[model samples]
Target: MGKIASAHAYANNEVAYLAWDIDGKIEGCLGFEVVRIYLEPDGSVSLRDDGEEDRVPCAAWVGFKGQRNPHWLPQTTSIWPVQKLSWRDLTLRKRRNRAQLRPSEISVRYEIRPLGDWRPGLEPAPDPVPETVAVAKRGADGRPVLDADDRSVKIEAKAYDGKPRPLGYLGPAVATNAIRVTRWIGPFQSTFTNGVLAAQWLRNVIWEDGVKRPNELMGMISDPKNGIRKYLAGDVLPMLRELFEQAGSFLLALYELDDNELVDLLLANKNRIRLILANTGLVEGEWDVRNSHARQALIDANVDIQHRMFNNSTHIGHNKFVVHLDDDDAPVAVFTGSTNWTTTGLAGQTNNAIIIEDRNVAKAFADCWHRMLNDPLDLPTEFDDGMPDNQQGAPFRTSNETPARFTLDNGAKLEVWFSPNMPARRKSSAIPPDLREIYRLMRKAEQAILFLAFYPGQSGKDCIVGEAIEIGRTDQRLIVSGAVSSAQAMPNYVPGRKNDRNDPEDDEEAVSPHTFTEANVSIVRASRLDDRDLLSDFGGEELTAKGGIGAIIHDKVVVIDPLSDDCAVIFGSHNLGFKASYSNDENLVIVRGDKALAAAYAVHVLDVYDHYRFRAIEAELRRQGKKGWSGFLATEDTWLDPYADGAKGALMRYFARG
Candidate 1:
């Protein structure tokens, strides 16, 4: 069957054309330059490139410069948005007495010449398969441990070909081309070669668990135009609802709830949605979770909340996320982070949230979410125990299995790590997949590492994940700064000199631990983060304030060597802590290959580091030669009343003490 194709999509939009040469990416003709086919007033069409008139091949495409198809695959370069053919309408407005391109442009009916007698639609330029290959190996949770260069280099059977030839577009994985792209990925190519296509984005949507308690839900709701409603309800909530309507099915994994408005919104779309909501009884106000208005609203919407309940009936279902599946019943989108669905959480507290649009990543999250529905009875605490028999909830999912690597738009990669933290329940059973991946990634750092965890009591140099980064630091490195807790357990602190692991005679390691405050890593307590005292090296940017959300950097982020080839960042509610590792249901999304992203976060890290490095100097003076993790302000009340604030801080400091 011959397919008649036309470059018609997105009714009433300008059209651009790309003519793919017979050369593959190996020969470096990978990027096809888009050209506009202009219709002269004489009814003669002329090509923008070299004036090719009647005979030209083109594919219809729509989207902004940096955007792409939802799947964003190689096939996406040829995805047809409108089946038959879409129209393009253009109207030029009055220019501000400036430069103009098309003189008072009007809509033009763009025409594309058919290639040969049959047009089999717009066929994407073929990709040449590689001679040798190494893709991500998956673990139980579908995440692979990327190598030091932020990718798992898999060397398969190598075959010698005469030279690079156009093997006729079979999905470019050919030898040297593979090596080149794999080594240093470029835009568009990464999204296709990697499994699921995702346009990588970092949206720092945060709620301040700051100094001033933001106005109540009612107060903010009253002024929908400019208050919390504008940012939270109007903005954030609608995106989720839109996702639900478009998705095939839904999974709700929340730690706490009570945001009546959000619940009501979900209820409004309940019939159109197929949802499985799992809560940890946090909304019941039993443990650390705040109260929410989920139950009644769910009941009103006839939403079934029974079967998937993960209340501490056994394990604390301390996970937070919502997974959406497309009509094909596969995962489409995922939402996760440190937020509990509550009026206060969205409108008041310092929190984080993320929305990822990737079938591969979404599928992984969906798999993890549905596995929780099985609700195993209990997890085996003993390292000696085989797989826990009950399989009650999302158990530790790991192995030396395979890792799934997803490349989104603009040469960016997203590697997801979710958990029951289940991995080796026998030998290295001590570290589950979630924590272990963190350990593996941190261990791969060659140059630098930056961290900013809202809560650090559960993490330290001695902790497994913490030790991975500390123990594996390159022979010489900067004085690490950020969370005060990670600063514990240092070898020795010589004010001006950096650590020298390669020097055979630098055995200052044998010095008495007492005099050296011993911590090579400088500690800066966010609780005491103050701009009045510290000057930022990045700019006079006021990151640290006397009081505000800035007072507490509540984001769990890890930026590894922002300027390196292996640049990457991992963050989410998945705090690199002991508690978050073994018990809490958390998430970590690692983004690689995007320099702009790494640099953006690099500024944040460097800013925090600069601010804290300055603060550490002041803190040491205040410490009066104290030799341990310094005490910091505690999160005593609001969300944690009756929970002795002193005990929590004291215990954390004690655990983190050198």
Candidate 2:
């Protein structure tokens, strides 16, 4: 076996570094997450020891979001060069220059089973045992401890007779030590196809006045098909530079914009630009991974500016949008989505950018962009119409009459949403208007529901759609990846994803496959395109063909029955995760009464699901091993395409036969 790649597993969940040996080779496939990536003096990578300063390239301690992991144990590691995964998207991890290898914290999960329940006979059963568990203080010396350090899970164990105690001793409770479920990840590729790849000027020839009026320009570079040209982020720069020459003023909000070419372009016309970017996640001084130079260059230019834009601790200024104002100060157009203005964000990654020239829409986005520039900490004012249930700042009591939608002549209707709640001054968790639209679409589904989410946060949030699926009980499918969530837990029913369920905090309303099996929702956690998810005969092999372009389920898209009257699509960078709805500065477009668009998105969903479902199947086969799985596949290897019209029926038959 040859070594195709080596990676550094930063933590329990993330793979911070991946080095694909495109020309050369390495050996030994450990088949686990890579814990430490060391840089040698001569520019080679190592997992055993730390490397030199100048030679050491990109590195980060990307840890798990809500996992109980042992800090002392070796982080997960994996080796590649196998005949499986594709090596596309590896370029995105471009030696994050000038950044040091950061350290990460390990989380411990604590479980307090009653002396009677876990270790019965230790003491008589306490009266009215409500199963209340407490957190422990010490580490691995005596017993397991809970990872309560900034973790999302806050367990209120109702088994013992108490409340969720502070991160310490189990006050006057059972004499049982806690149970620790430490999670560690292995080396894997993260598809960051999060970039804006098209130019508005290039898409259309009919433009009234220099700007393309009523322009519905769309750009997504997930892999190019035969005869289709792949557009890169740099392609948009020349267009923007051209616009920069024309527009008198510009407003922008971005997560990161350190790409040298793009930075040079921005700096070239810095005088007229008003930029709002994210606050650095790293501290000041010493190898800065935040790319402070880009911000410094802008500061030096002295244009109207707002640095320290996002607060990852609270809400991210996760807006990759630009609002251009003409000489008269009238907002002309707006471009937005999940892309950062970085090099990897552009050419090396996957992304989408929609440029809408509707004057009202531009105004709304421009308003939000400027509002955040002034107050980066507090949530912006409710910028759009409210939900159907008479939310605090919504224009209507119900979604049916909300005033956020505007339509084009072609019968294509669009609605815009801004985050945090309204009245910018108060604390609000009011769901964004677009999310309510998602709920509406889920509820309206008479036949099917499909979703590709990057984050499906706590069970409560996922349950909003889950509840809809439960009610509809139709052909439901979900492809979740990148991060783990209790509401949408993976790991299979055999083991039951105990690690995900261990946290008591998600107890009240976490939704998962287990919660929705009664509704028959076919839930599958997505793997990188290179994994064994695709059927070899059914173009699973095409994964190698679509290398670098076969992206992760990064598209936060929802597709309802395309032919139905209420057929709808909700997409754009907005994550369905709880944090996305509650805090981050995100946007979602709700297209209602659009049959053609709905059908297109529906087909796209099928294409994505078919590509990954087999990975889930293969995972099962792997668990069963060579005999049973091999026997099943040997006889039934050739099946109809999962994307075929009668796929549901065929799937039912296959499962029934199996």
Backbone atom clashes (below 3 Å) for every candidate: 44, 39
Give me the overall lDDT of model 2: 0.40
Work out how many backbone clashes candidate 2 has. 39
TM-score to native of every candidate shown: 0.47, 0.49
Candidate 1's displacement at residue 548, Å, is 12
| Residue-wise C-alpha lDDT for candidate 2, range 1-658, written one tens digit per residue | 2322222111111112111121122121111121222333343443333534221111111112222112111111111111211111111222122111122222211111111111322332223223245322323332233354522223343322212111111112211111111111111111223121221112221111123233112212322221112233323443455556775678887767666766776788788788876643434322224556787777788756665343334545566777878889899777665556654455443343445656776787786775565453332232121112211223211221232567754566778776643333223456545466667667656555666554454442443444444544544443211111122434232223444567865445422332122334555544322224322211111121123332234456676655567777666567664455555566666777766455434443444444445444454445454321221111111221221223333222221111
Off by over 4 Å in 2: 1-248, 280-288, 308-312, 347-350, 374-403, 422-434, 459-468, 471-520, 529-551, 623-658
**Root-mean-square deviation (CA) per prediction:** 23.6, 23.2
